[model samples]
Target: MSIETWLAFFVACWLISLSPGAGAVASMASGMNYGFARGYWNALGLQLALVLQIVIVAAGVGALLATSALAFALIKWFGVLYLLYLAIRQWRAPAQTMTLEHRPIGRPLSLVLRGFVINFSNPKAIIFILAVLPQFLDPGRPMLMQYLIMAVTMVAVDLVVMAGYTGLAAKALRLLNSPQQQRLLNRSFGVMFGVAAGLLATVRRV
Candidate 1:
């Protein structure tokens, strides 16, 4: 990829990461429950899923998956169900005062897995990547190297964006002093997750 093409892709990466989706909801949810220090593991899991998606696209499996109605439906339903599960969990979270120091720490691996599932199950992401990544590809240049660059660029941007989302929620948590306030915020996040699931359920291959 030339410098100009790479630069354009880099900008696109930021925009993609900034867009609100299941990943953002997961990040904020984790941050709300845990603080930035532990919640950031969710971002790592998200990056892992992202890299895998890029690899799938680069290897051309994304095209096959996109065309397969059964595969797409399976993945899409899984994602929707998972998001609804998350929403229910959030809704049922015990009401407590907002105190990061006093709150019990969540297992990092569980958070990571949560993040991975949130991204990995989204068929829309695979299709989006399949459509977008090829636009910057140079048929005259080596393909593997271009894919590697794009993957790295996308992951780096997404990490930063997820961190910002997580941190923002953590900071917001500090302002809520009562259990009522905490419960309200938690349920709000639950609703957000449900909304995300609804949106995901409506996605169709383009």
Candidate 2:
């Protein structure tokens, strides 16, 4: 890709990532509850999902899935259900305070799995990749190589932008001196997560 093409791709992906969505919700949750350390991982998980999403779309896997109505519907419904589940969990769980001595109690595999489901189940992610990427793809280049360049450019932008979000949220965490305030912050984040999930479930597919 030309320098201009790469620049444009970076800008496009950065703008998209800036949009408030599940990834942002997750980042905010992580920052509010666990501080910047966990927030960084949350951002990492979001970027990792983007890489997989871009690869799936670029290889024509998305085209195949788009063609199969049953497959699409099944995935879409599953995404909705997953979001609803997350909404309920966040709503029910009490607020948690972060400390230098204590850690959130979840298995590593389970944590990553939840991250994957939160991202992968969202069909809008696939659609976003399809719609945003090809506009800048070089028709004269090898398709796979073109996609690899695009994916790298996109993920890099997403990571940096998401890290920025995490940092800003972490700054807010520094203000609270008491566990009670931290608990309230946690509940506030939970409400935000529930709202995000509800929004996702109700958004009609185009």
TM-score per model over all chains: 0.98, 0.86
- Candidate 1 segments whose C-alpha is farther than 4 A from its true place: none
lDDT, model 2, position 172: 78
Q: What does candidate 2's lDDT look like per residue over 1-206, in tens digits? A: 78898888878777887988877777766665556766567666676677888888977897776667676667767876776676667656664455544535444455456667778877777876787788887889888888888877777877787777777877776566666776677666667766766776675445
The backbone clash count of each candidate, in order, is 0, 0
Quantify all predictions' global Cα lDDT against the true fold.
0.93, 0.71
TM-score of 2: 0.86
How do the residues 1-206 of candidate 1 rate in per-residue lDDT, one tens digit apiece?
A: 99999999999999999999999999998888888988989999999999999999988899999999999999999999999999999999999987866765989999999999999999999999999999999999999999999999999999999999999988887788999998999899999999999999999977
Sliding window of 10 residues with minimal summed lDDT for model 2: 100-109
Query: Would you list the clashing residue pairs of candidate 2?
Result: none
Error (Å) of candidate 1 at residue 183 is 0.5
